[model samples]
Target: MVLHAVPPTVPRLLTDRSTSEPDREALVVDGVGALTFGSWQRRATGLAERLRQRRVAPGDRVGLRFGAAEWLDFAVAYVAVQRLGAVAVPVSGDAAPAEVAHALADCAATGLVHGGGAPGWTGGWTHATADGDDDTGDGADLSTSDGLAQILYTSGTTARPKGVAATHANVTYGAGARHRPFRHSRHLLHAFSIGTNAAQVMLMTALLAHPAVVTLPQFTPLRFARAITRWSAGTVFVVPAMAMELLAVADGHDLSSVRLLGSAAAPLPGPVAARLAAAFPNATIVNYYTSTEAAPAQTAMTYDPERPDSVGRPIAGGGLRVTDEDGRPCAPGEIGAVWMRSPAPPRTYVGDTTTSGATFQDGWVRMGDVGYVDDDGFLFLVERDGDLVKTGAHRVSTLQVEAAIHEHPEVADAAVVGLPHEVLGVELAAVIVVSGGAALTPPALRAFLAGRLAPHEIPSLVHVVDKLPRNRGGKVDKRSLRRSLT
Candidate 1:
């Protein structure tokens, strides 16, 4: 298979990097082995040839299910699917069977490529692998910047996951936007699971960023921290949950090698950010906000003491605004719907007209969030639109309550949801996971929040759990929480 010179599409990006820096390390799976650009190109091409033999063609949807430990194979499979101009649909390896089945059936997938001994579906879907037949054969070039490239499902913390489809133009919008995203980093470290938007961003970073991407087979506080020291990683990224865990075990690790620490996939509380600042004394902590439907368009804020609550302004070339019910822009400091825009074409929901109509508009994507902007143009998110708790007379932000809960010394993880209340219409409820050797009760937690929160804002009922239920994106599964609570 030969790739000709083309525009800056996903396939073209891979070809450019491999040809220019074939001997450089492209990917490093800490516990597993590393793969250089040369090896990655050859393996991906061979896999693409094999997939072509299996009758896969352009515009076909191919499912990629590989365990976390199989990052190398997953990378090859993803690039191979792109090389063949097929739409890649990746699901978390640990996703439930039913979830996997839904994605395959919903997309009417043409074939599947799974590794690490993943179970095969019962349906008559053709199966292939990255390590499978490697026959070198000539193939037609069917790739284009406008062609659909991949489909990513939302985390579905509050409802069923929606498939967000993106084209090659959307995926490779910023391929050459900068000389290098992380100037000081030689190795970018993260342990995000496969099939997530975060994981996709990291994959692109491996191909485009200055650093060689490094990841662990699994994510544990100790293991992740140790990888930083062992690899001398200059940049690191994690979600809020992982950041909290890292702080717990940060005492023994020499994390000074890190210059930038980024948190994404969920909100980062003010208190948590303060603690992270002290824990990684030398690192500049930052928070990133974006959704599965919105990529290459995001807001990033390097921690500022003055605007601790802000999620930061839009990066260069991106646009952000808060609008009211009529889709009119709201003034600064006014709470409204959040919308973001990028130069690339926006992604849309697959086969869901109602949702697609509401989400993707003229050139902006509705964030499905409620937030405001400061006079200085920094964005501050109040809550996910669906997470707002509307009681009898007051509207509450779950993010505000959760942020307060995280301030409690005994709290390890917390989630707030509105429960059915016959008289009040809806009542505030909180589910909390206490730190090890710590004991907390409903009354005790409420007492801690007395001065910090208003009466209506405080949770009416609280439950202690060994762990808060979370989806693959490290976000609390509030839909599941409501099911068990009621």
Candidate 2:
């Protein structure tokens, strides 16, 4: 197989990398072995040609359905779709038929490529299938900078998921861009699903910098910990929940090779952050704050002793503001809605003008999160705008309550939500996961938090659960929690 440099699009990044270093390891899986740069380019391009042979043309939406550990199929289809100039929509392989149907209808996808999700595919779109293979040849380079490259669906909690349309430039920011090389970079380990922004960042990093991208196709506490030791992965990215899980079992595994640990997709609880810092003492531990819609509009920080809760300031080229309900700026330390402007050029929702009108205004996207910046210019998220609870005459933040609960040594994990009340408009309710061999009572737990939180923020009712339900993206599925209670 021969390789050559192409354009700056993602497909070209792979093809170009293959040319520059054909024998270098590109994608690594435990049981599936590895794919060299040359082999990956050859296989991905041949699949792109097959996609073109079908009526799957440029500007079409292609749904890619695959399970968690099937990165090889997922990565190939991603390159294949983009190489053919079609917008790829990655659907969770575990989605129910109703859920899959909704996504298929929402994007009006032209093709459904069932790589490894369900037994066979069912969709109105034409179908393309992928197992795995390698045949050398190049496909047509039809991608443009401004063309719609992907339509990533958000994990819908309250309503149907909305599609976020990303342009080629929006997704391929660092591909072939100039950056100083790292001193001792090794493989990058991440267990992120293919659809998330963090996963895309890892993909770009793999193409641009990392010699190989190591992943846990399936994420369990032990498996995640052992992968680090097995691969000697230098960098790892995880959501706060995954980070928590790793904290629980990481002691058994050797993680000395890690030099950079990144957390995002949710707030890293202060206690959890401290534990992770100690666990990876030599690593530069950082947490990022970003949204699906207002992506690349992120703030990051290397963990600080004094400002542990702050999610850092606006990164270079990014914009941020905490504004009152009337659109005026909030004073430092005053809580307000967070609005962000991405470093990438403006983006709007696909086929949802009502939401587009409400969110995308003057190039700024309303983040729908409530937060405040501290005196030292560090941003702190209080809660989601809709997640705030109104109890009697006062409002409360669930995150504040949950943070306090996590401070208790007996509490492993906790989630707070507003429950319907007869007297008060809404009452605070706590769902907790206690540590192993530890027992917690409602009265004792309430007393534990009484000193840490305001009286109004304390839970009126407590329920002990073995685990909190998590969505595909690892966020607490409050909607499911509500359903389970009712």
Candidate 3:
């Protein structure tokens, strides 16, 4: 059942939940422990007190270093920072010391709290504790009081990761902008690292909607399936990469209670989406799309066999426009640059004005996507940011080629990139990970996509490998793949 409207602040939501159902299970870390709403608050309060003692004043940025397996501690520190009117800068638990240093410096973080996952980070800040008086978490939640609440870093696939500063509303999004407990899914589940935007979504959803949010310390196919069975989770969020793992072992676990399964981060390759749809027959399989900078303006599509490639239209109060290279609007079926506009405050690149200016234009954020809206207004993503391949006179979409490759039943996952070619400027290449050790050849795959893609879209060369290279966020590392193969 739906609860009443929620407070604007993150801490306030926790406070209200504890006030309403102090005994209810608010968070569960599979294989580790569980916390009631009240218990979680005490720890957050304890953390806040420590931060205050360390001179972490309002508007200060506190770096949270935790790995995928340390959600409980990460959760406490994240809220504790907000409790003190400070911005939370989450650094992935597994980040290299150098990477962590860059993120901390980029946000001008004053201190750091580790979950023991950041092995070499030399930054300062005490680990969060939950031993304080019950009144500790009772402090005002200034998350929504104006200044930034979080500075999430984009995956540094190309260069230095940019800090994307988000206000409380920006990070929370408040159950699609409504402040209420959206309990359509009684319990929520996910295995996302704390720093990513998708993980923040799960965090906010747990506070605003799901009664008990269960998370895996680190997402493993077997562990993920077990969490759903053990907690009887009704909703689960996974990136396509994690989704692949879940699909591999879903048969060994009892996942009958799940009612909604969502995928975000990168597009769920067509074959994987289809597999997920079949695996969770009782659930509505959803394909959602969002980025670190472009959020709330996200798109979602319930799996439709007839149009599995479509990422669906923009959410309410938001829309997408496809513009040609010349900055002119494209008609339906015409591919071009995709831009997103949402009602939330526009995002800013913390210290990089040149990149921010090029990305955030007028009121719309350049999604750095190349795709088009269909006749039905559905937005189908062709390629993501910097995911273009210049081939001869054609600019080919790697995603299009990957999707076509994924359509082949023998293929498990695929990544496409452009390689330098003496005659055509750049030629297409594909790295494919086959399903069940299935036999496939570059020539056979090319013939399969012949009807679906243009001559230039098919990979001129294909590498059959055991796996595709993926970055920390579970997205294909096209650049790395290109560099290695070339």
Candidate 2 residue lDDT tens string, 440-484 = 999999998888888999999999999999877778999899778
Q: Tell me the lDDT of model 1 at 21.
A: 90
Candidate 1: regions farther than 4 A off: 1-7, 128-137
Q: Which pairs, if any, clash in model 1?
A: none
Error of 3 at 51 (Å): 1.3
The global Cα lDDT (0 to 1) of model 1 is 0.85
Error of 1 at 426 (Å): 2.0
Scored against the true structure, residue 253 in model 2 reaches a CA lDDT of: 77
lDDT, candidate 1, 1-486, per-residue tens = 223333366767777888989999989999788888878878888888878888889999989988888898888888888888899999878888899888888888886788857888776464546454433546654678889889988887756788889998888776755476786999999989898999999998888888899998889999998999999999999998899888888898999989999999988887788888988878999999988998878999988878776789888589999999898999998989999988878888888997787888888999989999989889989888766779989988888898899899888888899999999999999998888898788999999999999999999989998877777788878888999999
Model 2 CA deviation exceeding 4 Å by range: 1-7, 125-132, 180-183
TM-scores for all candidates: the values are 0.95, 0.95, 0.92
The segments of candidate 3 whose C-alpha lies over 4 angstroms from its true place after superposition are 1-7, 120-144, 175-184
Selected candidate, larger lDDT, 1 vs 3:
1
lDDT by residue (301-336, candidate 3, tens digit) is 998888888888888578789998889999999988
Q: Per-residue error at 337 for model 1, in Å?
A: 1.1
Model 1: lowest-lDDT 10 consecutive positions: 1-10
Highest-TM-score candidate: 1
